[model samples]
Target: MPANPQAYRPETALLDLGDTFWDPVDAADFPATTLRFRNDAAAAEVGLDTLSDAEWTRHFGRFAPLPGTLPQPLALRYHGHQFRQYNPDIGDGRGFTFAPLRDGAGRLMDLGTKGSGQTPYSRFGDGRLTLKGGVREILATEMLEALHVPTSRTLSLIETGEDLVRGDEPSPTRSAVLVRLSHGHIRIGTFQRLAYHQDEAGMRALVGYVLRQLYGEDGDDPVRLLDLVVERTATLAARYMAAGFVHGVLNSDNINVTGESFDYGPWRFAPTWDPAFTAAYFDHAGLYAFGRQPEAIHWDVMQLAASLRLVAESDPLIETLQTFAPRYQAGIREAMFWRLGIRRFDDRRDHAVVQAVERVPRATDTPIDRFFFDWFGGHVPADYPDAFDELRRLLDPYTPRKDRDHPYWHGEPCSMLIDEVEAIWAPIAADDDWSRLHAKVAAIREMGAALA
Candidate 1:
């Protein structure tokens, strides 16, 4: 890697940009002649700093700065199973780790680049990323974070000075590299790789490394490590279901061992509970639909536990796997209750909530996105009159006529709180006044505090 210029160099921090395998000459495969750098807010929370103009071009490509600072680079290496098969040939192909940053809470975060350039893991294809793909990732991270899911944050996107050819869509459209910040990048497949090679020492080393990096050395019991991963996986899976998110690809490579959600590709949030809804075009079999995520996560956990056989026994591992289903269900119930603003968790109420959600038309199905708007905008329809008169008017248009007679109407008063929330968030989504948006968010935070 090249050294940073004096003005761009950090005085106390180590300047460790560029991977050991990075090759600037491989820029030939990219249609874009230059790459640009941008800051990611999510990455910033973890303490990432953007690179200076000269440093960005020298390391990332000849791309210019896009009105943001560039952070130091940090390359990450991990093994993962692709499509259930162990593959040792995977790690930051077109992307490399940018630096780690500390957030307001002092949590260490890693900033990484996607589509920055090519590395040894590029395989046979160009390591460039598409602008559309970058945009989708930004949307995924932003939306998922707002929904309170354990997800990687999309920090920034910089359009390259060139175009790239792809098999899908146009031959040469615009290209970009996205920066994402997350807890850790280690994956379940990372252990699987060592297990497949019968490298017990490597597996042990990797596990120890993970314990030190993510859980601290004091919490390094093999069983405990396995259990933590299982528990976190269950919690994350439940959160995904609550948020209506489908990862589209749950391959081992995409399963972060640290339990943080990573690698957002072909992901989607469902508008309804269709078990077969898929986000990836290539997921023809629906193996990774929204409904299958929990099961897929269980399978991935089993694989991770199996890889730990070198350090522990199979019986205890299988026992850990058995705990996944119940744990996932419990977590899902809790998350759903929070999302719906339910104060109590009763089986009957849970059933009612599910039924009510099923009956409510999706945002895309009608003008429901604006339902709360109309309600809070001070117009109340008479047909669905109730204590939540405003909310009833908002939801009446989306409710089917047949289910209008349900007893769920008893809980109608809750709609006032929901309406208030919508009123607070609507302007933010519309890109209304920034000061007003901040005030609204503050108000929402206060509401959350009051609820607590």
Candidate 2:
């Protein structure tokens, strides 16, 4: 049964909060706009699946707040240490929270934009996203969600007819506006922005608000918050490893308060389990590389701990921060087992199994997804390949979570390789042939459903 949209209260509550953490803003009216994508599946959760294309555009693209939601848009204010260098001048430069809504469980969710327009933090840059950029983000979010990573869902993509020049890609490319549906958009940087101003009241207000809106509580204990953040960050990093994903950027500003992943820029799933493989072209130091993701995310969690000092003592926060490493290790083990589709087994033998599987990939430099596709859930065949002999033997002591007869077990995996992504994008970029892109999205969703 469809949930009553009015049972959702955050949309009204946020509007009543009256721009405490954000500034009122208006969307840039664009030219020759056309809706390019709509996530009906995600919208249905909020009872918005019935919205017509024009209605979706009028609300999402034009920033017209939905009925029973916020009355206006808000460009959230924030500051962050970009690459460990303190940067006070950062916030929602190109995007804003258009409105807040609730899912079936009545959990608060924000429908925010990525290329809406310039805010106070725009500095001297153009506040527009390229059409290709939006498409890449959609692919990234979809693939991550399929891998069971708590990630954002790209709700809509609208091409706003504009020719933009950028050094990162080919100049005079297409432009777009993107809307993402997620648990919340608040970040460690959000609090850091307030701490920079030494606004104690603001910090306390934010802590309380985040606890209530996102965490389902109103407790103001910053230490408890830090603990939750550490655990969530650890689990998030573990999931990234299991999925062979490198987020590319692990800045505090990019880390969502709810621990879900969003802002998919310069992200990639590893072709091979190479620790040093990086996604961003300019990430010369590999600061946010594949294996170093746990380190990067741990650092972000600590920064969040630092911000909590405004309302709590540093000792408890620091003590909670120390849990990140051990939590991350445990998280890795759990996620690794889940990926293999095994819930219970001999722990010692499971360790051996994990080592065996990892050794095969490391030694052969094989694609990580291939291993899962072939041997997931401890499915071992008599004719198994020689490379996985150790893995197969290790599986002898294990049991799968389900019967190994699921249709997904017997085929070439639906891989989201970068090459394949480009193959899908080539037609769209060259001849505006969206058929391939549409097909890829459908295939990816099917693969996700099968895995689920």
Candidate 3:
């Protein structure tokens, strides 16, 4: 009922950077608005949970500006490498930053849209998103967050009265729009855009803006910025590996400057510990496969360094880039421990546990999440293979974070593999039933609390 929630803090930080970053745009006037999904939990973080369904639909579904947020949407501009190929023309073709605001913790966040409408970067295609695509993103973000992977949160999904034809899915699929909450939307390609044009001043200004707003730093040192980005990026890759997730696209545009994962497309969890597992059908080369995700992200980080080269010396950038490998390795070790619910010991012992964790799954073709679920807190299940003996011994000295008594750990571990995703979507597409989807989300949240 309140016009402005007491906890919400609207911000115009992105606008302060000026027009060099984005172009103001209007949201699409949809034929009909049908609210499909609402993330009340995420809304609560931003003090918008008290809104009635009508108010929520008005603000998100119809693109009505939040009370004190951006008066109009801004279609962001940036360029990225698409599967190792440089693409200078691509930007937010179908999405725009709708609101810039801070959460309850005062952390700067952006409410961005997908399938909103065409922009300068729309090119020849219609700016629309498939309903199934929006659903997939919701599942991806939920599972990743439950697994403790840093990622964007799906805020809302609304069905627009239109059918879309796509090459990937069955034609005449339902269309919808998605809103996501992210720490920041500045991608590495954002810098690449400035570098491609040889715009040193824009690069400097962007760097300063990123530091001040996202990281809370005040300096414009690109090298130092690159270092921080590399650390977060490597850790993100490590966490993805730990969670058995393959982000089908690791292009420069998809890699956020803040290192938080966003823009979920064709993402999947590996059913088994197979290195060659890939999520996207179009990825013939497996460049972004499950095991090679670390490499792909590292390559992206290199490209980020190359973009910073326009303003800073290359030697220090290269040196900072070198730290990515060790940080990634250490990150993997830490992530493995976290998943296993074990307190980390020294590197030698921790490395042994990680090696055993990695080896046992591949050797036995074990389900990734199930393996962690069964062996959580180092309690080796009766069915655990003898190959896990080494890991069990390594886990002995470390303290366990949780016992197997939690109800969530009692049955089959919740997984979001491709087949399960299709099962969850089948009813929604055929009969418009969303019960399974809702139930799955509740189960995942329970898993997250158990893990926490």
Tens digit of lDDT per residue, candidate 2, span 294-360? 9888888777888878778988888898898888877777888888887757667766766776678
TM-score of 3: 0.98
Displacement of the residue 264 alpha carbon in candidate 1, Å:
1.8
Candidate 1 wrongly placed segments (more than 4 Å): 1-44, 47-77, 217-219, 346-452
TM-score of each prediction: 0.70, 0.95, 0.98
- Which is better, 1 or 3, measured by lDDT? 3
Kindly list the per-residue Cα lDDT of model 1 for residues 249-356, writing each as its tens digit.
Answer: 898778887778877777776655666788789888888887898988888888899889988888888888889888886777666555544343466555454444
Deviation in angstroms for 51 in model 1? Answer: 8.5
The 10-residue segment of model 3 with minimum total lDDT is 1-10
CA-only RMSD, every prediction: 9.7, 2.1, 1.1
- Stretches of candidate 2 off by over 4 Å are 1-10, 15-20, 381-387
lDDT of 3: 0.90
The true-structure Cα RMSD of candidate 2 reads 2.1
Q: Number of backbone collisions per candidate, in order?
A: 20, 0, 0
Cα error of candidate 3 at position 90, Å: 0.6
Ranking by TM-score: 3, 2, 1
Candidate 2 has a TM-score of 0.95
The residue pairs that clash in candidate 3, if any, are: none
Give lDDT tens digits, candidate 3, residues 1-452: 32446787888899878898998888888887899999989988887778888988888888899877788999999999999999999989999998888897788999999999899999987889999999999999999999989999999999998889898889899999999999999999999999999999999999999988999887999998998999999999999999999999999999998999999888889999998999889999999999999999999999999999999999999999999999999999888889998888798888878888888889999899888888888776777768777776777788887776789977888899899899999999999999999999999999998898
